[model samples]
Target chain A: MFDNIDKTDINELGEFGLIKHLTQTVELTQESSNKGIGDDAAVLDFSGYKTLISTDLLLENIHFDLRYVPLKHLGYKAVQVNLSDIYAMNGIASQITFSIGLSSKFPLEAIEEIYEGALIACKKYGVDLIGGDTSASAQGLVISVTSIGYAKEEKIAYRSGAQEGDLLCVSGDLGGAYVGLQLLEREKQIYLENPNIQPDLEGKDYIVERQLKPEARKDVIDLLAHLDITPTSMIDVSDGLASEILHICNASNVGCKLYEEKIPLDPMTYETAREFGLDPTVCALSGGEDYELLFTIPQADYDKVKGQLDISVIGYITEPAAGKEMISKSGHVHEIKAQGWNAFKNKS
Target chain B: MFDNIDKTDINELGEFGLIKHLTQTVELTQESSNKGIGDDAAVLDFSGYKTLISTDLLLENIHFDLRYVPLKHLGYKAVQVNLSDIYAMNGIASQITFSIGLSSKFPLEAIEEIYEGALIACKKYGVDLIGGDTSASAQGLVISVTSIGYAKEEKIAYRSGAQEGDLLCVSGDLGGAYVGLQLLEREKQIYLENPNIQPDLEGKDYIVERQLKPEARKDVIDLLAHLDITPTSMIDVSDGLASEILHICNASNVGCKLYEEKIPLDPMTYETAREFGLDPTVCALSGGEDYELLFTIPQADYDKVKGQLDISVIGYITEPAAGKEMISKSGHVHEIKAQGWNAFKNKS
Candidate 1:
């Protein structure tokens, strides 16, 4: 699929040579990093800080399709999603270990594209690429990333910390990634049906980029720290807005009322959803892969984030008796349920 | 393959339900583990110690053959191999995050069997299962494990610390895992040709266990600490004795002379090699997956570990000009070369 690229057989480099070639450019900048690649394990010093760890596994034909997704974008999105987990806990990511399994179908140059994207993400986020393993796969490509970070004990946020009467907030926009996927799949089908026609992705750059190269909401965490606001509960919006809200409610033994009209949606996402006969509200409520941060803070702390342009006050926490509900734009109250993104629909 | 077990559909539990069900019994026992599952990221307090992180990727049909390897054994062996990396650094493993991608061919019971074995290893090694991601694969099983641990700054060992006059030592016997693999493959071939035949595996339990259920050498680290002896360099023998010794030599800018007679070999491994018309010494030199610790220490510390039954002094380090060489039983000096394990030979 990577046309015009020199097809260097992966066997030419072998496992050790490939690893050394890929990691030769890594320059450790983290004070915590004592030793990196070329050892049995990476050594670090998280003295006086609580360490945070998160891992993710992405399998081809399951979590992603290489037909439309660029290898560079895939690597970048993978790192961002994992880093989002650390930021979701109000931590700063310091290092990441990435492991990949590839079939012989992949050339050395193809692997390099993926690692280049990964390194770009690490460099952009000021995170060190420490250690990882590479192996041959029996089928499609497989990627697994482990992100490590640190936070002060008092600054760490958990899902069970929300209290009644707290304001539920979200960062940036939602549903863009899900809408973007719809567009990509539609274009892929059209191309399969007619090879002569080019993909009509005009004016869809915003949502497409969101899907292919989403960034972790590290800035939001930094913003909260700068504002001296430690959120009572926080989670990244990786599983759609409604699902994340319900997670906070269930974990905290409370209820929530999310306002559909208040949910932020980029105009392009709404327009594309309408074009595809999909309800933009439903898309934002159920669509996933938006790496925005969702958090809850006490009502008294509202003034701290009220005027922040990137922050949105979308709902409020309620008593358990109230139940988890959503107020639609049409003035109807409905129970909020989680329709988690199922990437395994084809196989099952 | 798992006979006499209920084959509950994995889809019945969904992704979230399956994760909850599998991790329901995970009781965090480490003081370093401030928070584990049910969070965005696992929170660990390694405030006073340097942290060590290691990751490994295992792909079915590449790293293992499930026709003969049990699910539980695969799980246990996966954890042990990752932990062996931490122990190779002279560190105690404290936590592990395990991620697995499975095809729909697997039942919920099959997954539970794997997780059960993994949890057992964690309990036995006093490590906690903190966090991980689960997903569906399009083909065979894919497993990625990340092990975390800690050690005092002065107690950690690195491949670059070997000195010219350091004594080379190895723990446990070599060549057993490789021989075990040979026997299993032989049995598999026999069974495949004639299903009604009962494969002859009597009296081979030791080597078979070495291949299927190897253990990390945590006791050796504890013993070394008790004796107040710290090695100058160390590595786990996962890629054969020659490869590991060469790694130490290259990294430390030194050479070594390995004695064939001093290489510890279990009598079963030796006899099994002979039975297969393979040279026992060659197997010790090139057979991988032993999980034995190979280290180099100052010659002055030899008396401290001289009488230890598990510790064997195999050789001594020399100046770089001497080059890496191994002495045969007949006193013939031959240059030592690394024959690294290649699990991907079939694919690549």
Candidate 2:
């Protein structure tokens, strides 16, 4: 797709020149996007709508190991994670600003590869690339994606809107991304031990793809709208089910009772996770990077979501005095804990 | 000020706890800010208004050498540069998303110092700290700020709005940041050579402060509103004066003739440039990070802005065929070139 973009030096095109070259083909399709690119700031008219803004920062080696992660998938995932936040808010992402801090080791082609993936993702999601900053990093790559979306006021959902008796639900299966990550890590270790060996990954396509290129819950948001049901509270599961529900519980001043048997998991994820001697439930509870919507709805709306196969009711809300609890398959209740990633706390 | 915050391990609080601790005191004051922090995404209501969005990325050792830059000042300037872009479009910034990729080297206290500076700036500007993602960087510190503002439809300005015969104008003096950078670099080298001697920085406060904690031109935007003179075209001077003017010209499809005599310069900036064996005009034209607003107004608005104290009419727009030219102090006309900071091209 990026024909004749082979070996040209980045310096030859310069910063502004390179930016102009990459975004030259970008076309603005949204009427609300009154202006896109080529300005001090992009002008957007979100009159009569509630605007949603979210930002995410991705760091190489810390967020993804570049040895196993392709540059294109990295760029695409950066956008997906940010847009997932918007989707979790029950909003439609309309624009995104992609800023990158590239290190000296990267070539023009490498940056172009990343941009190509970002552009393709933006096109697929109907979001226009607006304004962003491009700079050189002294070390590794830094990708920052800020996604903007809009929604009708009545359709929006907040994490603090959950109430007692609301059904806790999740869209799509969990733990697949975590299982895929484990598979990739195993393959990488094998390659490190023997570079000449062609490592195995033939039938592990499902987990690998889930780990490498997780999609945002845009369709789930649309399907919810189509079903004429708005979630009482919502959040994307980027930091595992446990962390997210805890967040909602704290925000809403409510307690949740989660059922392990009701949690959705792919067959491959379960089998592969057990093969690695890891509990699949533990992986889904704390592994993260799923990008699936986790939400709650009233008991009245539970029947409406029952017909949807992708939707799974995993738990229900309770009074704040009850505290956040999770029930195991054997019927033991345990308090939920947050074991999410902390940048500063990692190893120090 | 942040005395008691000493040596708390970041992991002890975890990611969400750290973020909540840092932003707990962030009070939302903007009317358009429907929600501030603690959500899947920020909720902003910009009904009946056109919104402006701008983003900027700052990398360690690339944008600033932390050996001299205070973490607090770095944090303050990061938000300023991003807000300046929004102000250039004749918009009032209402919300911002601040994302940081901090390395393991920084302690909890160090990160809080940076956050303190950012919060102070946001409070001063009446912008709500909306939503952002924080992650661990394997390398150095990376700060990315995305500012969102609102502008009245008729009051907004664009780089492509300049017409023939429009008067080019600039707010505040230029080249101070470049001069300050030179002084800091000289002092750093001296310190490296001899640790015993305190580096000479007695009377260079004006320039040094300009570089370290440059403020966004929010007052200039207010002044323009007071004068009832909307700029025909505008751009913030993140890039050098020449480069920014060229951007405006390219966007507007018009030529410019900048008068060297009319370019405003602080006395310190001019004398410091001469001491460094550099031309003041060249410094103003090519040196960047001034964070001033450069704009154009119709010839009719000249009288409206004539009484403005800090505004300077440095040039006029010309026909496209005339091309971009600058008249020197000695009355020599030459084509203005883009010698701005091109991260990749600078070395090659």
What TM-score, computed on C-alpha atoms, does each candidate reach? 0.99, 0.97
C-alpha-based local distance difference test score of model 1 = 0.93
Model 2 residue B294 CA deviation in Å: 0.9
Task: List ranges where model 2 is wrong by over 4 Å.
Answer: A1-5, B1-5
Residue A48 local lDDT, model 1? 93
Tens digit per residue, CA lDDT, model 2, A1-348: 234456666777888888888788888877789998888899999988999999988888888888788889988888898899999999999999998888656778888878888888899899999978787788888899999999999889999999999999999999999999999999899999998978688899998989999999899998999998999999999988999999899999999999999989999999999999999999899888999999999999978999899999999999999999999999999999987555555656
Model 2 steric clash pairs = none
Q: Local error of candidate 2 at B270, Å?
A: 0.8
Q: What 10-residue stretch in candidate 1 chain A is worst by lDDT?
A: A339-348
lDDT of 2 by residue, B1-348 (tens): 234456766667767778888888888899999997889889999999999999989888888887789888888888898899999999999999998888666778888888888888898888888877677778888999999999999999999999999999999999999999999999999888997879798999999998999999999999999988899899988778999999999999999999999999999999999999999998899998899999999999999888887999999999999999999999999999989877877546
**Of the candidates shown, which would achieve the greatest lDDT relative to the real structure?**
1
Docking class of 1: medium
Off by over 4 Å in 1: A344-346, B344-346
User: Local error of candidate 1 at A8, Å?
Assistant: 0.6
Please list the Cα RMSD from the true structure of every candidate, rounded to 1 decimal place.
1.0, 2.2
lDDT of 1 by residue, B64-132 (tens): 999899999998999999999999999999999999999988999999988988999999999999999
